[model samples]
Target chain A: MMLNLAPNIADPDDFYAELVNSQRNLDEEQALRMNARLILLLANHIGDRTVLTEAIARARAAG
Target chain B: MTNHIYPKFGYLRSKEQADGVVKRHPIVVIGAGPIGLTAALDFAARGQPVVVLDDNDTVSIGSRAVCYAKRPLEIWDRLDCASPMVDRGVSWKVGKVFFHDQLSYQFDLLPESDHQWPAMINLQQYHLEEILVAKCRANPLIDLRWKHRLISLKQPADHATLAVETPDGIFTMEAEWVIACDGANSDTRKMVGAEFTGQFFQDRFLIADVAMKADFPTERWFWFDPPFHPGQSVLLHRQADNIWRIDFQLGWEADPDAERQPERVIPRIRAMLGEDAQFSLEWVSIYQFACRRIDNFRQGRVLFAGDAAHQVSPFGARGANTGVQDIDNLAWKLAMVLRGEAPEALLDSYHEERAYAADDNILNSTRATDFITPKTKVSRYFRDAVLELAQHHGFARPLVNSGRLSVPTPYATSALNTPDEDFAIGEMRPGTNAADAPISVAGKPSWFLHCLGDGFTVVTFGKATDKTGIAIGPLAAKIIRVGRDIEDPSGLLAARYGASPGTTYLFRPDQYVAARWSGFDETKIIEAMLRATGQDSARHPAGQKELAA
Candidate 1:
């Protein structure tokens, strides 16, 4: 029913490294496209629209 | 296992030539493929006489349209052919997708269901045609003629005339109504001057049916850049009779004829299945992906169904499945019109609803084709990124679109549906296909669909009373009371259908929910039935304030 925004990844640093390494050889445009795709994939994974809207507002506020 | 031998239905001479007079028929269906034959059988079962015309005398040549989806299977079940097809075909739902030899994700199409049919079945089109042809031959109302091709068509003011070319000579015939179930290259379509316009993907695929003894499970296996075939996608499915359908994506420029040769194809199969795998090539064909449909399916007295009306890529198994649904939608309406029970305007809804379905199928097919064969570098990048992320991330799994396996498109915004007023209770809403639930009929377990016969059906959760009257124009609707007449011991009829004690649901002839209410009101039920049959154009009398209690 509600969103769980807690840290759930087993090894956060290892996942961050893996995600960065996956985009190692991509150019600027490709990297941007990959980021957009990642955002979409994650958004779809967090299927609840309410949580997605909250996450979007929080990220925008931080920026 | 023995190879399927195509049965030949001997050619019958037209009675028009023997009698030297043209006799008009109620319905004349062109093309004896799966669509045409199914329409003829459906018409005959509804007490309408039909004459089927086909150019060929035998069934389909290769295993064309091998995947039969559930919606079409449900329609076929009403015509008394789904059980035989299911008994012979391989029923499957689990599909495994791999990215560069690494398994990415797996999906179950129908995770939970007590429906009468499976989500998908891998059966050869010819096997289905054989069953339909046999059924048509047994029916006294269906006059099937082989080697009788429609060379020309003329639709005058009242009726349509067709020029047929037979083995002996050409003959002319007249019909009250004409249905074109012809294949993609339709002579009827050309004669009517209707254009099929859409996009054609710049990719070719080689489909080879190989007969082999293997232990592969009956599931769809798809691979992107496997070790055996690099830089292209491959699909493998296990059909009946130990035949395996293997498709390898060939680039647009690949020579179709050269690639079909055994010297060229055997090596590819040998690479995929170890070099020593014993197999004999059964059938091989090359095809380009294209998603196209006509502007309209109905033109005056002549109607188009199946591939003649629309076509989609084979990715989602939508071509034949949608065609069968077209028949299920059009048959009852056409019958009612021919009997003068409903107005001819009912035929227009067939065009409105099926054209909507065609657009939906084409959209899904185009998206699948683009995902499989990305046109631009950016597209490929996103596709690859999705695949890469799907391997580890749960969120990315939904982005993998090998093919969005075909499901019945709900007619959510059709003119026939009576909008829900209070709340949407169940998944079976108006304009949606009635979901099948288990129940007991006379103390024996049966399906709810079995109780809802071919005509317009009204089902009530409790006992039927004087208030539960349902009439569609001149046709008297069949009413079924679940708790009183039919026993529902499992309570699934109430649970799945979202029914209360006095809830009533009106279903169209095709078993689509036309309207539902908390309690049966005869006036409201009759109005809904008339609106569903395109009779009362009074625009769904505004509010439901009168039924608050």
Candidate 2:
């Protein structure tokens, strides 16, 4: 299966703003913990191995 | 009074010249460091004559390269030097990482108990060199010349001629092959006009060895921005002979000379220890990090190993461990070529395999250095964020890279590997280093690695097999039937190797998996043997395409 290259999330600005807002007012440590938790939760939600592999490849390529 | 004494090795006279001409040797190693001595001893064990030339007669001065990983220890075990090292060195696998006087996380590298050696040992490099040098001296085939320096080298197609300068006079000697392990500032590399290219991190670290009697547990203790030294990282390791190695991260602008002074260094030590804690300074040096390697490890008849071929920061303990591995990979190939079992083209695989390992080391080291000493404000911000999160969250703990400890690099995509076939059970795939597990030989406890001699070995899980049809050219091959001749009491051999009854494996001299099959197939085994020795082109196993799909 190919990666979902198309825009999946609607209102990209709203999502970006929400991400920044979640980290807002939190200390450096708290912000880091929040991001880590978010990553873990999303990863658990998307537990498909093939999709994870594709996403990892895309991220590495972009990096 | 400190009991650490630098052992002085007696120099041996150069072999007498025949009719006013220097005699040629089969192999010449240019340095007496751990890497050079390891190569010489390995070659000697393989029944190849070797000559080792060094400018100094003494072991390494400081406690340099203090960490010995498991793979190198296993290689040393094959050479019969691992026992002394494990006996003398401080063996530990648990590491505790702290942030600002609070324990952030702790890790156990090897939690399983089936392996013969621990994850790593903390021993001074001099002690290891002393052991290796003694072994080389005991071997009749190894000629070690101390105080002999290489002045120039000329490779004339068939052989390489090296001009050496001794205390008495200069002389010239010829060799079928030359291995340059002369260290970072290698003269042989200069003589060959090879370029070592890489970036140097703009950071300095102070290494202090102190002799103290303390009750601290024998474990690696690392601190990032402790109360004693704010905004810096500190690494503490307990070595043999009541000596403790402490490394403090000094910023790029710190004065190396000032930091090395006893007056300046004592305060830092006192801060870590209480004011009344007693300790004597042993050795101090300042170092900078550089991740660089030569483009090619082999240049015609002369090959480079150890620090001469590549250099990485000491963060991951990759410097000496990887260097020892270089010798491990090259020794068998060189011995095979010298014995005419394989063609000269086989030597190219050395360059291919070790250069890949060097790149792997450099990549890990670079990432660790970048994480530890972040280059920009944004990077530092994220680094501190991750560090802070690591204190509480388990998921963030893996993101913390104080230093990823060194592990053996698998040559998964190597040209010599016959890729994995139908059997896929464990991580022990083709092109991977062999995993050591506890087993029983004739009802006696033994290690599976010990059963693999210094030649291509065919290991079958059960029942002895006569495969006279399999031909590996002029190279020797041994067949080991585990269940029939040997017993796996713990069943670790089968578990770790992913073997079952009638399972078969082809292992190279360096204990790397060359191929595997569910049952003995003479034609496929012969093809794998030829490819592993670089006699035939690398062909992907028929099952590989299916597995990839």
Give the Å shift of residue B437 in candidate 2: 1.1
How far off is model 2, as Cα RMSD?
A: 4.9
> Global CA lDDT of candidate 1, please?
0.86
**DockQ of candidate 2, scored on C-alphas against the true complex (2 decimals):** 0.17
Query: Residue B102's C-alpha lDDT in candidate 2?
Result: 79
Q: List the per-model TM-score of the A chain.
A: 0.85, 0.76
Give candidate 1 regions above 4 Å deviation: A1-63, B1-3, B464-469, B537-549
**Candidate 2, B145: how far from true, in Å?**
0.4
lDDT tens string, model 2, B393-470?
Answer: 775677677888999889878989887777575788888899998888777888899988898898887764754224
TM-score of 1: 0.90
